[model samples]
Target: MNYFFSHFHVYRSSNMILLLFLLVLHQQHYFIKPIYAYSRVEDLAINCGTESNSIVLANKRIWIGDATNSKHFSVLESSPQKNQSSISVATPHRDDPYGTSRISHYEFTYSIHGVTPGHKFIKLHFNPASYPNFHPSKSVFSVKAGPYTLLRDFNASGAAQEHRDHHHHSDPNKILLIEYQHCIKVEPGQNLTLTFIPNTTHKDSYAFVNGIEVMSLFKYHDQCNKQKKSRFRFSEVVHHEESCMNCSPSAQPPPSQTKPASISGGVLYCVIAVSVFISMSSIFLLCIWVWRNSRMKHKAKMELIYEETTNSRKSSITLASGNSCRCFSIIEISAATINFDDIFVVGVGGFGKVYKGYIDDGTKPIAIKRFIPENGVQGVQEFKNEVEMLSQLSHPHLVPLIGYCNDEDDMIIVYDFMANGTLRDHLYGTCNTPLSWKQRLKICIGAGLGLEYLHSGAKFKIIHRDVKTSNILLDEEWVAKVSDFGLSKIGPNGESKFHVSTEVKGSLGYLDPEYSKTKRLTHKSDVYSFGVVLLEVLCGRAPLLRKVEGPKRCLVEWARSCQSEGPHAIDQMVDPFIRGKIVQECLSKFVEMALNCVVHEGNQRPSMGQVVEGLELALQLQLKSED
Candidate 1:
């Protein structure tokens, strides 16, 4: 009886310990947490356009129009991308937003930057609905992203027809958009450069893209190694307008190597290609159709000048502050520029070339901009807009517009020559000497003042559509001035709404995600760009440089990451060259102000005036450090 009692007591004690252990685990589940080794991140969904914003399509957000060392296709410069007809293609199931706009060139390259680099999925969307004048056969094009050649001499319409055959004759007319997605390994901090080259054999001789989507999946190249056979594999998503959506699963794998099907090798390869093309083309048609209906109704958007007359009364534009724009006659401008001579060529930009010239009896040095029509539709629009915006707006921070000449085909404007070139040239660009910390702060202050003027100083609010380091020009006195006005647009007109929906325009790294998504043009968009400039000025880095490491590659991403880890972490983010020159408090304040400007939500961003105020505080701190 004693042995039995002892054994029972031991068993009960063991059971009690087990119950206690369970209780601890349950309590820990609610209270104390174990550090997890891995986290399941949300899949990245990136949709962008070349010119139009996210509203161009309900699916796209991350617009990609501005490119370094690239030419933008004018909407009418090259024949239309497709036959945009509702009768032929049927109304898009969804209300398409892009209208009938597409960017095309003989050879165009797009560099998609500031992305989560890894093995990500890419969906190249196209609207190949041909115009009546364009030849469907001439739609042949090729695409190369990184080292991967996704398409070669591809006849978009032919691919769509094959897609139709593959789909067993689905609603052919309803198809407008087509999507083709493939998995590829991305090196850390690598910008995806997509080269679209028109096939020489094709008569159309131009390439275009209406929409693009990028999804970041795994964050390592090894993801490709793990699934080598399937890495290059792709699936298709076909969106015919807003309503009709269809998705085709991955194409069946090619016949086995060891035990092939009874089909001949040539036949087998052809069959495999057909199957893949069928899938790709179906999805591709879905992407192309959205523009046809909306485009037909909005053809006059190009003619519409969404602007304000800064100089409405006379030849000389009178500014609100009484600054006058001296309009030059065509004869006078010709004498000044010497007929747009190559010898006078000073700089080149998205649409035209700049020439150093002389006016006022060859006494005053000036920069003359000559537009190239073939560059794209934005060229003419930019020229007109620049003249109008520059004439009306005047500030110490803005580059002074001396005069403009619009005589027949001679479209040109003259401005005070910026002897120091771009602010970019001074910061690790052409200029050899690194700007001192004090000098840098002064320049930042000047830039902020210029942006502030654009946002509030003028009678009408203006948003500089393109704000980047390169656009900030430095004059002979080392005074920084905001220059480019081609992308500038009038801010929202309605008092009720905070933003105006406009076509997306801006550089890759500096683009505001909020504006990219909502197509809302606001003063806040410029703030985000200024934040990028602040980071660049502090770090002496390019906005997006593939040559750098993954973490430090994109200035915006790198700074944001560093800021999140506290001010000490920002130490690592600052430029090594400028580290000792910076005061800790000033540097921290500057970074805090910058990060605040670039917040994902526009409302959270401070105005240019606020940014200026913060800079003033930073200046005081810098002065204290110097003392």
Candidate 2:
């Protein structure tokens, strides 16, 4: 009896130890298993509508074509024809995935299997081109991923045209490719299927795709965790996905995977109870550490960006007495702008929305420019540059900087409100009355003076790189002021420097051909852009009228052609509103000066000072003709 009792005691002790080990593993199973499974999964990129071999891009990403017959994806369509011809002109993308696309006249589906269960990034590539008998305009279709609607009645050609028009791209032959991206969640054992349905309501409508990319969210999270320098957060991507899904939860996991609960004895219950208490305590402590660490890191990053911007402008700020550019808090800005209500939005541009708000307790009016957060480093640089440049320089013709707000993720600039809005608003695209001949000449003179001040009168020579009508704002008295110094650059201080070699950046159609070709920016580059603005003022139209056909499509080319046809041909091109109002002599002198500013060589283009003087002369002639 003593021997048997001793052996039973040893067996019970061994059972207890094994039970504790099993309990610890059960507590961590949910967290550890998913991570391990995610690491094993890989990203996928497929070239659609092609039977060609796999393609290797410069970025070292291998893209498998549909012809590979990979188990990862299967197409419902039996025969998908490849794009007959490649894009004839140079495209924006470095890779040529757009060369071969899968075009379908009827509905089709792509069943993608083996995707790991998690949030995934879906990228659909499209090249809007005329494929064989398929017209680009007729390629209107809807896309769906399971229960989610990715796109509805989407027109690729219209979208491409809109993009071209927005950027003022004058080249009609330039191809515009598009890549639509979305984030989605996949449940366990659920295959991702993409369906492309043609719009049956529209006659001859079809669907096409150039490429498809499926990337796991864990891949981004893993990279983010590995690289301390990366600013992107996995949480932010998940937030974006949630927003894309309209804040709806993902579909429930398959019911077949659900397991039944089994009854346990009193001893097993006691083991589970102890494990639950210990596991909850450990998880709580870990979460606290992670949250604190993330907060500290985020704070440090924001401070770094702020410090860099402040340090770069220290010299400029010191020169300007430090108080010239005030710093406003986000709270004050939000209160003044009514929390950025749509009704308060006075203007919208590439940077962001401009809100007209009351500051200093509704006594003072201010124009607040909110920078788009997604603009990232480029937007930050612009914000810094504008503040640095504007703080040091002050002139009546230049818009006054009231203050700025760099609170948290918001980068905002406060400026003196212009009652009359932009010069473009008055020139066209509005019902505002056209300015008289003298008024137009005076506005031109004021704008020219602003550009001249930037080129010569400033403490340091500055070049207003983006000189366009839209950047010229008019005040209550109709006085023109140069605005948007984000693109401005400090030019050669003396004759010794000559030019600043930099990447070309300006609105298309107004970009200086010489500067674009050589990548050498100079004061004459601004002069060329101002010349385009001058043409805009004279013709009362945009720099490029996409609707106009042939040579008449481009204002500059059409103007040059008219000038070549003799002096009489030039008069026919004047804006009808000021047709007879302009003195012939004044018009001739103005046209000659404007043309001189846009000459082929920078050396041939007239200086900003000369432009100011010539405009003043034209104004004098107009006044003399009135007398």
Q: Give candidates' CA RMSD values in order.
A: 28.9, 19.7
Per-residue lDDT tens digits of candidate 1, residues 1-627? Answer: 564456456556656866897899999878863322123232322222323233434544434333212232111222244443111121223233222333354566655555455666566666556644456567778888788887777666666664444233455455535555555766776767667777877555556554454555422222332221111111233544444344446555677677645558879898677667555555544444565566765655423421222122114323335546666676666555444544345577767888766655544668888876444435656777788888787799999998777664456778888876777766753313568888888889999999898888887888997888889988867898999898898887447777888888888999998999988889899999999999888887678875556877778888888878887888877767688778888988899899898899998999999999999899899999788
Model 2 agreement with the true structure over 1-627: per-residue lDDT tens digits: 564446456556656865896899988775564212333264788887666656565666667776568878887753345442222222233354665777776787888877777666677888777677678889899999887788888887776665555345555445667767666667678879898888989898888887888876433232111111101011000111112444456655556865654556666887677567556555655665697799999888877766765554344322266556778998888777656755456688899999877776565768899998656567777877887788888888999899898876788999998877788877765435667777777888899888899999988899888989989998888899999999889998766889999989999889999999999999999999999888888988788876768987888888899899987888888887898778889999999998888888999999988998999999888889879
Q: Which regions of candidate 1 are displaced past 4 Å?
A: 1-323, 329-331, 547-549, 566-568
Model 1 earns a TM-score of 0.49
**lDDT value, residue 390 of candidate 1:** 88
RMSD in angstroms, candidate 1?
28.9
What TM-score, computed on C-alpha atoms, does each candidate reach?
0.49, 0.52
lDDT of 1: 0.66
